[model samples]
Target: MTLVKSLYAGIATASFVLAALPAAAEDDVKIVASFSILGDMVEEVVGDLATVTTIVGPDADAHVYQPSVADARAVAQADIIFVNGLGFETWSDTLISESGTEATVHVATAGITPVKVDGMTDPHAWNSLSNGVIYVTNVAAAMKEAMPEHAGEITANADAYIAELEALDAETKSKLADLPANRRTVVTAHDAFGYLADAYGLTFLAPVGIATEAEPSAKDLAVLIDQLKAEGAAALFVENITSPALVQQISEETGIVIGGRLFSDALSERGGPATSYLTMFQHNLGTLLDALAHETAS
Candidate 1:
């Protein structure tokens, strides 16, 4: 289990990163997260009360994730497991089954209503800070279930985490309140920001929808380019998990400059700008405001 945790932390052959910040775990309960985002959430709510292990690490795409042997082993040893579960991790089911883990698998987005795209669940609920509160609530409940003795401590931690989320929610709305309707339209690499757009009054157009499993077809790219040309956009941004090549191509064809990187499905590395879920959203909000709001102000 130790080796498996190390593997997820990228002490071996993987580009993935550690779960969260500098905190020593009590190691009381073994927790497995399907990806870095959930890992960070688990850390925030449970603090050091639980030993959290992540399967998909920093800047890695969970939609197309391939679970490792180490991940399976970790899941097998876990006392609790957290997954986003809107068909987000296609590989999670197989991995959990093969591992024969008896750990209670918790879905962070279980209670929230999901955004649908073409009759498919968007699976990116964490994009909105409001929905993130739901995630933290679910995490806190699961932690209490796993370690009943630490219920008081877990509740306190979850309250702090939720407070932060609520603060950010207010900040987002305040910051974006002045943004005009015409300037609210933005372009991203994929359709992962629907919840965010809905929550904050923005419109996101993308070449790829929901997941990045398939490369955007030429027609899809053409359509996106044409839409941007016809209606215009505030800014075009690329996701951390996706390649900038497609975005670059769209920019060249449509004459819209690429804005900056957005942490869509994953968090950045430990020393990077967005190591935790809160920081990831903060970073993305800043990026958007810098390009859309700041530029408009200037």
Candidate 2:
């Protein structure tokens, strides 16, 4: 009886220790982002307080991304999920439903006034630094709500990041001001830059609609080419997320020089030019200015 009692006590102690082990190991909050850009923002806000898993990574097209089993698993395990939520991730709703996670879903673009084109809300609001401030605010609030113990840290990080975004906004405006007004028209593979155009006072034209999944009609392409020729738009840009073939074909047809690759829907991979949000904006500005400057000089 004495030996049996001792064995039972040891089993209970082992069970208690095993249960407490998870409590000790689960220190960081698990966050899942719908894409790379939002992943970067969440990482910046959470710092070391959370582990962020991005579903659609850098240089990948989220518009057509099909979430895999691993992605669904990540969502299932996440404590919080951040999504852009302007119909940006078409697959996200189904994935979230399938994941069956009770995690809080936060739309990063909650408070911003979205620009609508053809009755569709533009999901690329992050293109404008001013709107980026709103994104950070929403992300910070979500993080605070999820992990109240780290609220102070999250707020400080968000404030610092927003300040950087403000500086980037000012710099973008100043750089764009140097371009000739006539050369301010930008043509890209898709209509991903409406927010950027609206914010920075440039005119953006695209053959295809906002979502890459939407195929551009022959009529649309013809109209865009005619408009480009009529407007004498000098620069055409290829987006990092899209195939350059369509833009290349457009350039060949119109004799408009391909300006450069723009980081439209996604950031560049790590160790690339447009790695971070700040660097992405800087690189894009430089590319536009370089091309526009050349056009103005010619």
Best by lDDT: 2
True lDDT of residue 205, candidate 2 = 86
**Model 1 scores what on Cα lDDT?**
0.85
Tens-digit lDDT track for model 1 on 32-117? 99999989999998888878999999999998876675776688667899999999998888777656667898999988998987
Q: Taking the tens digit of each residue's C-alpha lDDT, what string does model 2 give over 40-99?
A: 988899999989999999999999997765676677667899999888999888778756
Q: Quote model 1's TM-score.
A: 0.89
- Winning model by TM-score: 2
Instruction: Give lDDT: candidate 1, residue 236.
Output: 85
Score residue 121 of candidate 2 by CA lDDT: 92
Window of ten residues with lowest summed lDDT in model 2 = 3-12
**Model 2 TM-score (2 dp):** 0.90
- Give residue 187's error in model 2 in angstroms: 0.6
